[model samples]
Target: MHEPDYGVAGRTAIVTGASQGIGKAIAETLAASGANVVICSRAQERVDPVAEAIDDECEGTALAVECNVREREQVDALVDATVAEFGGVDVLVNNAGGEFVAPFEDISPNGWNAIVDLNLNGTVHCTQVAGEVMRENGGGSIVNLSSVNGQHAAPGESHYGAAKAAIIRLTETLAVEWAPHGIRVNCVAPGLIQTPGVAETLGIDSEQMPEREEVDRRIGHGEEIADLVQFLVSPAASFVTGETVTAKGVPKPGNSMSEGLGLE
Candidate 1:
């Protein structure tokens, strides 16, 4: 009997923002599965250790590249380095983004621009560069990391939410435009994934954390998101494209204020 193959082993994959968190998990997962991985972030110091660790644990190769996705030149350099090291590109994951929590009125124009540039334009840089390599290679998979805020209201994160929502539309458009090139594009929207960095950012002490099931109600692990990314890039999802998979456990309804901005 012929069995199913994920078609990931021996592939070359570039995962941006992979110095830690979900991006690191995804890079590790792909390396362990025998895919040569190029992991990058804004600082070489941040990515070198991750590459070293993956190289030690996985049979496949891992290359560390320093890239600030917001800069198109740096992004192009990153793709060039990946091609030089791995020979070609097969998968690209756009996972670098950050946002600050504040009321819309309190957010400065510069602050809003920073979020949009990092979240939306950063994705554009990586996708366009990597897509070029994919085109030359005949096909590839691109998975973007969005956020649940893109779909729902985030009172304190309006800028980030808007950028992520835009990413969803970009994924759809690219999926269609690149279909002829055999490239697939998709998005993953995660909410409150539990990581050391995230905990520190949110001022949550790890010592007081509950069990996995309890915590998973409101927060998930980076590995959970990594798994979804793997599936999206694997042959199992060959028929899947231009979709946004939300990984925020179960949804719970909430009461809305009487008059924020009525849709009436």
Candidate 2:
């Protein structure tokens, strides 16, 4: 029997915020699968080592670039650098975004704009710049990272939810607009994921959670999201676009109940 091909080999992919967590996993996963990966974060120091490590361990190449997606100049440089290194980009993952917990009334204009700039505007910058290259190259895939809060309520994270929700709409619109260019745009909405940052924020150790049988029922790992992203960008999902894939694991029976509605 012939082995199934995910069809990412020899492709060049750029993943933003790839210094850690879901972004890191996606970069490494793509590199390991024979796709030349360009990993970027706001700091060169954080992403350089990851690039070197991928070079040592993976079958494909890894390049590290420092970029703040909110800035169009830096994002342009990142795309140009990737294109210079690997000819043209075949996949792009907009995975850099953040938000602070605060009530709607407490959210300052600057704070709200900051979150929206990072989550929504940032995606716009990267997609537009990268889409141009992909359009010229005949085809490519673009994946935007969203959050489950965008679908449900996030009391203390209203700004975050709003920004993520905008990303969903942007993904759908871009998918249709770019279809003629063969550029597929999609979004991934991940619920609770077990990562160091999340663990620290929640005052729980994810390292220890796996030792318990509850691991199966607990939050997912960054690798799981990476797996979904891998599929979405690969040939396995050629027919998929303008879609939001939620990787939140199984929902509890009472999640929709009033008593179960609570913020993280």
Candidate 3:
């Protein structure tokens, strides 16, 4: 008659791109579960309010840091700040990423590089930096944010799909390589979630999203994704690693190009 234990209370975690959207939801969810959370974004102004809000409402403490995950130095500083505040890192959520829709041929080299750097290189930087602390501390969990587009064909988002696909491969490899160190690595590929960015870019609002119960080709919510992330990083999933969990609603049998173009 015992319930599954999350084992996150009092642990320390860092969630990147936590200023808003999926990242913000993950941070708030973890903090509510009693994990001291450090939330970061590219600008101090962007993440400060989120940290303050988490502090006000959650059981755990929240720290705000300005970090561009593409920069190794910034990633180092973010990890250092986390360790200084909470002693060590027990979890990392690599959620900082961005992309724009354009045909493969229309994408400029600079544009392609920017998207790849942010989505793929940024994850590499954070994982390497925070992973060092996790290794030293005997073990930790890392959850990466990917998208459904990575698994399917993306007509207008070739760069983004490529980067995200790389993340999945990286997760699998790292999971195997780091298993001996007691570290666990996993990836979450979410489908069309109604984040603010999605609302802006795709004209899809949470109000328009179907209820969770009506699970046929519906948009998802950040909280639902957050809940999945929480479980993945918690003791409940102790035996799970090197896996990519897709949280998109049930797939339909047709062209999904339009859906992939606006994946958030």
Please write out the lDDT profile of model 1 over residues 1-264, one tens digit for every residue: 876666589999999999988899999998889999999999999999999999999978899999999999999999999999888899999998888788999999999999999999999999999999999999999999999899999789899999999999999999999999999999999988866556665566754444434342446778889888988999989999999999986432231322323421
Model 1 residue 36 CA deviation (Å) reads 0.7
Global lDDT of each candidate: 0.88, 0.89, 0.91
Per-prediction CA RMSD (Å): 5.3, 4.2, 4.8
User: Which is superior by TM-score, 2 or 3?
Assistant: 3
What clash pairs does model 3 have?
none
Q: Estimate each model's TM-score.
A: 0.90, 0.90, 0.91
Question: Whose lDDT is higher: candidate 2's or candidate 3's?
Answer: 3
In terms of lDDT, the poorest run of 10 residues in model 1 is 252-261
Q: After superposing candidate 1 on the true structure, give the runs of residues whose Cα lies further than 4 Å from its correct spot.
A: 206-218, 251-264
Clashing pairs in 1: none
Off by over 4 Å in 2: 1-4, 200-217, 251-264
Question: What is candidate 2's lDDT per residue for 1-264, written digit by digit as tens?
Answer: 866558688999999999988899999999999999999999999999999999999999999999999999999999999999999999999998777788999999999999999989998999989989999999999999999889889788999999999999999998999999999999999988877656665566867655554333357888999999999998889899999999987644444532354521
Please identify which of the two predictions, 1 or 3, would achieve the higher lDDT against the true structure: 3
> How many pairs in model 3 have backbone atoms within 3 A of each other, for residues 3 or more apart or on separate chains, i.e. clashes?
0
Clash count for each candidate, listed in order shown: 0, 0, 0
